[model samples]
Target: MGWLSTIIVGFIVGVLAKLLHPGNDKLGFIMTTLLGIAGAALAGFVGEALGWYAVGEAAGWIASTVFAIIILAVYTRVIRKR
Candidate 1:
């Protein structure tokens, strides 16, 4: 149940992040989902280190979405540079 919810949320977050990020980066749905999931995981670590949220606590929807977008942006930038 927990894993299911996480994947669903990550999918939604990934779609939202992809939409928010304006570019021509071609990525399939699966790739986008993976990116989103990775973004969420990264956000979790960042939030914990920055004291933005408690470790193991649920990240609010908006925060997670924004965090995912930030991650996506950085990812795209890095990919572009390479």
Candidate 2:
């Protein structure tokens, strides 16, 4: 996908992640988008390493969501402590 498409998908994924995760994260638009992009990147890397996806392949929604949730958890932990 193109960069624009990726950004759009990342935004959607981020929104979903925020919704799926319990509690209010208080993240703004840019942070949420970055969170989603980071989650997608994490899922893609792990999937590729495990041979579940080929190079340049995008991660599926489930994997992206799962990764996003994990990221959100970490973000909450680290940010809330500050």
What Cα-based lDDT does every candidate model obtain? 0.78, 0.85
List ranges where model 1 is wrong by over 4 Å.
45-59
Q: What TM-score should be assigned to candidate 2?
A: 0.87
Per-prediction TM-score to the true structure, in the order listed: 0.72, 0.87
Give the per-residue lDDT digits (tens) of candidate 2, residues 1-82: 6898878878888999999999989999998998888888888888878878665545566677789999999999998899
**Span of 10 residues, lowest total lDDT, candidate 1:** 55-64
Tens-place lDDT digits, model 1, residues 1-82: 9888778878987898888889976878887888778777778777777888885566745566787788778877989999
- Please give the lDDT score for candidate 2: 0.85
Best by lDDT: 2
